[model samples]
Structure formats: C-alpha cells, structure tokens
Target: MDATVFEQIRLMLWDVDGVLTNGDIFISAEGESFKQFNVKDGVAVALLAKHGVKTGVLSGKQSPALSKRCEQLGLDIVMTGIHNKIAALSAICKELSITPKQVAYIGDDVIDLEVMRHVALTFAPADAHMLIKNEADVVTQASGGRGVAREAAEHLLMSRGLSMDEVYKPLMDAWNATVVVQ
Candidate 1:
C-alpha cells in the first residue's frame, strides 16, 4: 500500500481471465474460446513500455487469444496454463535478473494471491472477488476488461513522481515537429 512500493516497480505482471476478460468465457460451436480485451488496457501497456517498464502475462488457463494478445502487445514474458504462478513468477524474475520486489502484480481471483503477495505492489479490479480485493494493495476503480490497466499505469507513474505528460511528451514533440501549415 505504500507509495514507495509502486515507485520500485519495474515489471508489471497480470493474470488473464478475470483481470482481462471480466471472467467470461465464450465458447463457439467448434469449442473455440474467445476473450475481449480493452483497447485502453493495450494503450496502458504501450505507455508502460514507453516509460521503460516491462510487462508480462501469467495465466491459469490456456487460450489462443491470450497468446495473440501478448504477441500484439509485445509482451515476451508470458506463461500460460499455469497452476503454480509463484514458481512461474520466480522463474520470470530470475530470467529478467530482477527480484520479486521489482514486480507489480494485478489479479482478480484467488489463484493470484500467492504471486500478488510476493510482488512489490498488488492491484485488483474493482469487481474482483471480495476476498482477493481485501488482500490487494490497490483496487482499481475500473472493472476488469475496462480501464483497470490504465488506472494502474497512472497510479504507478504518480507514485514515482512521474506524469502521463512525461510519458507522452516525446511523441507529441515528434508529431509537432513533423507538422506543416497547409
């Protein structure tokens, strides 16, 4: 809960289903599962990447859509079909040459508790299970599949004495430079 914890975050990890899809699984006649992701959340990941933060996905269930989304987001540290998230998280930390304290975890269900507890900062969606929310360091106002990721990004930047303006300033400047009067 301390602001300093957020300030120390360098990697952001997320659990899929509930945190990214409102916990809904749609299976078509061919048994293909589909999940909807929010564009705002994708932009939030882009913002974090812009600020030199690493992002990853750790999920309990296996879904093709999740992998596609991770690929599209340029997130390389992905682990799916995970029943033991803590071990996966540890392995990811080891691979990244960082400790758990450098990671911020966001979740919405019970399976995420162990990894969430081990990370430097923990966030839960507003509609997360009550028990999980109780254990989270921060609970986003936006529900899953909404703007929860964006909310977390803003909070992380603020905690570190940074701003969205700082994150977007370079691109804005580039755009302005390339503009010409017609």
Candidate 2:
C-alpha cells in the first residue's frame, strides 16, 4: 500500500484464470473452452487507460477467449502459454523501457509469485490462494471474477490523489455525446 509503489506503476499486468475469471474453465462437447469475464473489470481496464496506466496479460494457458478479451481491452502486451514468467516479464520490461519496479502485477496462483515479487506493487483477489494473498502488497476484498479489478483501479487512482470522477469524465462525456445524438 505504499503510495510510492503506486506512483511508480506505469504498467499493470494481470493473470487471467484466477485473477480475472475466478479460475473456472468450461468446455463444450466440441472441446472449445470458454471463460466468463466481469464487465466491471473491463471498465476498470478502460479507467486505467484513461489514467495513463497501461495494461497487459500473462497467462500460463492459451485461450481464444482470453485473446479476444485482451483485444477488446486494447491491450498490446499480452503473453500467453508462458512457463518462465520472469523471462517474459524481463522481455516486457525491455520492450517498454521500464524496470520491474515500474510495473504492478495481480495474480492468484503460485505461478505468479516470482513476477509478483519483482513488481512495484502486487495484488491478489480475496479468494486467491492463501500463499498468494500472503505475498501480496494488497489483498482486494473483492474476489476474482467479481470487482477486484475495479477495486484495484480505484486504489491506483486514489494513491495518486486522483478521483474516479476525474479519471472517467472524458469517457463519460464522449458516451453522453453519443447517447444524445441518438
């Protein structure tokens, strides 16, 4: 919860399965997997973008649903089917011209521990593995697939003395303009 950590966070990396989707995987008879993402979490991603924080995804497994969701969020730095998180993170850091300390990571499993340790800030959903929660700098009250990302986004803004109203004003204005035209 250090304000300095929040201040340093230029990129926010997320773990998809447990951190964003409640760790659930559903497969159809045809062998396609689907994951449900929280709508509020999508808004959180937009809010971060509005506030000048970039977002990315790192997942151990690959899924079309995850890829589509990242596309919708306009996230350009996504890494899926990753085994060596540290190496992936290192590459990301190099590409972005940032250090590990300039990033924040939210994760739920043991696979996330090493990268979580390196980031400026670490967050875990309330229902994350106990070990992950223990390692997190911030353990969100909201569980995964709920409003955890929203909570984290709010925290990010608050740490910088920014308000949600301020962060979302331009987006809301654009939305209002579109609605009024209809």
Candidate 3:
C-alpha cells in the first residue's frame, strides 16, 4: 500500500462489537447485556484524536454500553443502530465535509463491506471474518479487540513520517498524566 493513500485519511471509522470488543456479545433476558473492550483500543482512539484523525464507531446494533463507551472515547462520529451503512456513511461524510476518498474504515465482519468499499482505505483485524480480511486493503497483525486500532493508527502515523517512539510517547504520557491526587 502506498503511504500516500493513508495520508489522505481524515476520518477513521470503526465497527464496534467485533472490531473493538472481540465479538463476544453477552446477551441477557433483559437484552444486550454486555461486551468487553480492550483498554488498548481506548488508547488507540485517543492517539488518533491527538494526531488529528477523527475516530468513531458505526455499528449495526446499538446498546447502552456501546453508547457509553463512545462517549468516553470522545469520538467525532457515532452512528450505531445503523442498518444501512452506506447511507449512514454518506451522511457522516457530508456532515464532516469530507469525501469518501478521505476516509478509512476498519471493520471485522460482513456487515461492514459496503461502507468499507466506499472509503479511501479499508482495514481488517487479523481475526476478522474471512470475507472481510480478504477484501481489506490492510490486514492488521493484531486480532480484533487486541490493539488492532493501535496497529492501524501506528501505520497511518508512520506513513506521515512519524517514528514508533514519536507515535507512542504521547500515548504513554497521556496515561501517566491521568494520576489521581491522594
């Protein structure tokens, strides 16, 4: 893949359950009970934000837990409960005043294909569905919910001439800076 391709990415959208949560949704009688998320992904989103890449989730399903997590991430785009991803993505692009050629989408399953094709770049986690991985422009080494976002973000930044140290130092510093006063 050309480094210039990644340089054009202004918006990086993610798919929630599989991409960020290891694809295990715990359902209860009440409904949409819970899902586990990796702290590494949280750090990934924060890193993208600091580097001027808008990050967000576009899930076919929606739940309270998902909403809360997006809020904590401070995502610039959050469009869950989305059935028609292409339409939703179009709206998002219009809202952001960016063309599809300036967007990158990371998805882990079949549901994400439509939107992925419309974006400038497509990424899939190592453990993503075969169909998705086969179609992705980049198949990250890390599995879903296992710091794939970090890997993807690192790739994007490195394309822009940033070293690994330069990419990770702020992530480390930000975590260290959140100390609580005793």
Instruction: Evaluate all candidate structures by whole-model CA lDDT and list the values in order.
Output: 0.82, 0.84, 0.85
Compare the candidates by lDDT and give the number of the best one. Answer: 3
TM-scores for candidates 1 onward, in order: 0.89, 0.91, 0.92
lDDT of 3 by residue, 78-166 (tens): 99999999999999999999999989899998889888888889999999999999999989999988888778888888888889988
Query: Per-residue lDDT for 37-149 in model 1, tens only?
Result: 88777767766766678888899888788788888877758899998999999899999999999998899988888888898888999999988899988899999988787
Name the regions of candidate 2 deviating beyond 4 angstroms. 176-182
Q: Cα miss at 104, model 2 (Å)?
A: 0.5
**lDDT ranking, best first:** 3, 2, 1
TM-score-wise, the better of 2 and 3 is: 3
